[model samples]
Target: MAPLTSASDENTHQTLLNTLDIYSAPKPFRNASWKPPQRRNKNTKAILADAARKESSQVTTANSGTSTPAADTAPPNIAQAAQRLDRLVLEKSLIAPGPAVTYTNIEAAPSLRPERTRHYCDVTGLVAPYTDPKTRLRYHNVEVFNLIRTMGSAATEGYLEARGAHTVLK
Candidate 1:
């Protein structure tokens, strides 16, 4: 008879036991389900507000000897919140300048990165790799290039001037 030298035989049974969802408690441990709780996307602030309102309404009704269900109020949607933010900004501006080093939508924007300087097709506004030497208009493909060539010189100059690349000094 040969003694077992393999560790696999000992590990397999223990791993299987750990993986199983045992329904009954054996001795020391209490009966428990290890399954994860279900997930739900909920507005917790509105929930708490509803609960508070319910308690207050219940108290008032009990005192008056009348029973009434508390109406549940839903939280404001994104648009309403945005409008509120805009109003706050307007009010703040009217009152006084904000604290020092304050950053707003139009003010205190970060500078553009030189490494992220990407050209786009003037015609289609897509990522452009090819640049026409005549008008210096960025293009995505040969089709766009042909379109530029057919365009009048004034239009060609317009595209170049718009992008701050002047071919004809005008």
Candidate 2:
């Protein structure tokens, strides 16, 4: 049996003089902090800020008077939860006067080491040396990174859910 070799079509070859960015920007430009739709909002800043202050004040006043110990322990309203803050419940937020410590083989240790290495690629299931900061997804290589970037939010959530990293809202 003869080996089949050289399967590329040469006549139809297109010149690769220039590479077009599918997303219309290089990595740095695409990953920059400044978004294109950034509005100066010079005219609306005061109005928006005033509205936000009013809303928050209303929420705080409505919830502050009804504060009980049980209610304090539970999560607060939507705005408070989103900001991870409640001015009324300020007891638990203070830091304890001690340096954080990690103890191995101690069941009650706040910081315990994992049983094994868990840095695996979300897409390829291989050893991942890089993480996509935006998605918080570990990928094995650039190919996996490109694949992850092309994925829709639902698909990304599916991958995160498979790893038990998806957030559940009550």
Candidate 3:
């Protein structure tokens, strides 16, 4: 059997590196004839003019004291109409006397509350068996406990804040 030659090995290595370099480089943009469609300017102008004419005619009829069904039935503003509708609904509900079930009433039910709280490690997101009393942080093992112990007060507070247990002052 013939011994492996360095020249052929170097050439193969160089070819592999060149292939990797080609694959790593970004691909070139495609040469395409794509273009956006042109707008119908004349048709748009004619439609706008027709809309303006209709609006002007409506204004003239309104100014001449001719009452249309739409003008008579619709309110001046949408917000005021919504408020009036809300008031009517409230008045109707109050007059008819029914069960007044609310969000707070449902939440106050004993069955809705959890029986026991679940404790989880703040760092590893695992079930915590021990808690550090000083920082009040739950940990899975000594490693997480050591991590929490070495953290600064601000970092500890940040971790607590993420879990919605950080103390707040007014």
Candidate 4:
């Protein structure tokens, strides 16, 4: 039998090209089903601020308050525990200082549904580099998601503070 040659590969190449032309025309725009930012009620904000303040104060007092002479002798143990707790609070404080607040978002998997193609952003439809037959313009879902996630991560403090307050209520 003859070894497979690059010339023979042309047939597969042509077949892929034929298949690609069907998708070459950009997919129609689909309304991106992203959720909008939620509006916080003033009362809710006040309540949350109060709760977070209360919880942190309570935690500080309970963790720091002690009236035992033994506590002075075994100060290392208390100090170690206090140091760990302080470290944790400091870490959380960093997150709580972020500027932008986060709201939950639910995304549907992008799938080929011919009827729904016209509403979404065209950029979402582009195939990844390796998958495309040509090396031209390619759009990666991961890249887009990463960009968005980075923006969200930058707002970590606001997101955590709101989430923290909510968690305390629960």
Candidate 5:
């Protein structure tokens, strides 16, 4: 039987790596397709101030006018309208349950930290640290950038040896 060679091994191994979507980075969209939803450019405070001034002027004009308007210049009560909306949107249960109590002991609580896995990807020549989708997820932009930089130089082996290694005893 012939001994396993690293050079020929890497060529076949890389082919399997190329087949997996895990190694591929997401591509940018090609077209300037669609615009986001329309929104008022003016700040909420500014818009409110302008509306208040307009309402005040309307009240002043009405007071100075010869004719007495039937309705007052007061803005519609938004809170009352919101209350009406609450009744319309939300339904209450016929019978209400008693206050619920939950028991939580700090001593018995599990730690928020996650368990770490030490699996490394030597197949792609990624000798340095890389993300494992299963555990220890990394989110930092700098770490992700570093991973991409290091990934290009990662060591890859032939597909047959890689597959055989999994079946063979350590």
Candidate 6:
């Protein structure tokens, strides 16, 4: 039996050339006459300064407890409105507010955790039997363990971090 050669395969070469030709062909312009939107001639800094002036005037009038009809009707910024709502809620005892929910609090309890922790080798991505004490990197065999032992501190930390086992100090 003769071994099939790539150079002798005229059909495969022609197919590849045809594929390249199809890709290299000029694509049609979807929006040939399209133009970018025109920009405003206004100065951003001046606009910002004007807005700041208006905000400051409103704040001053509100703080003095002599807000005009226009100032009183204007909606408050999100942070200011949220603070006001919080204060109102606290004053009226609307809801029985408790401790803030966080990642640490929401995580599964120790009693609900799996009995056997699965360990995997960072290098091989296989079931690891041994863990290096210094680097805390799990290894499948002596060869992987030896590789981890010879790695620099940065490389060792990187391997541990990739597996989410790197120890962080305060």
Best lDDT goes to which candidate? 3
Candidate 4 residue lDDT tens string, 1-170: 43244555767767767776966776567657867779865764576567667766765566553322244455367787787667767755664453322122134234466573232212355444422122122236667545434544334334335434212333
Which sequence of candidate numbers ranks them by lDDT, best first?
3, 6, 1, 2, 4, 5
Which of 5 and 6 is ahead in lDDT?
A: 6
- The TM-scores of all predictions, comma-separated, are 0.34, 0.32, 0.34, 0.20, 0.21, 0.33
Error of 3 at 157 (Å): 0.5
Off by over 4 Å in 3: 1-114
lDDT of 1 by residue, 1-170 (tens): 33243455667656665667475446655457666669865574656567557755655555442222134532258886676567656754554353323223345446665467789998899999999887778999999999998999888878878877765555
Question: Across residues 41-97, which tens digit of lDDT does each residue of candidate 2 receive?
Answer: 554456656755776576556665444336546655687564444643452233222
Collision pairs in model 6: none
> Tell me, what's the RMSD of every candidate?
16.7, 26.5, 19.3, 28.9, 29.7, 19.3
lDDT of 5 at 36: 75
Question: What are the Cα lDDT values of the candidates?
Answer: 0.67, 0.64, 0.72, 0.48, 0.45, 0.70
Question: Which lDDT tens digits does candidate 3 get at residues 1-170?
Answer: 42244556667766767776966887567446767668745664566567557755755565443222245566788898887678666755554354333333443336666677778998899999898999999899998999999999999899899999999769
Q: How well does model 6 score by local distance difference test?
A: 0.70
Of the candidates numbered 4 and 5, which has the greater lDDT value? 4
- TM-score, predicted candidate 5 vs. hidden true structure: 0.21
Give the 10-residue window scoring lowest on summed lDDT in candidate 6.
Answer: 94-103
- Would you give me the overall lDDT of model 2? 0.64
lDDT by residue (tens digit), candidate 5, 1-170: 43244555776666766766564866666556877779868864676567657755764575444333235553378886676556433422211122212233234345678687444443343333654343222223455545544543212123224434323337
Q: What global local distance difference test value does model 1 have? A: 0.67
Judging by lDDT, tell me the better candidate of 2 and 3.
3
Write down the worst ten-residue block by lDDT for model 3.
Answer: 99-108
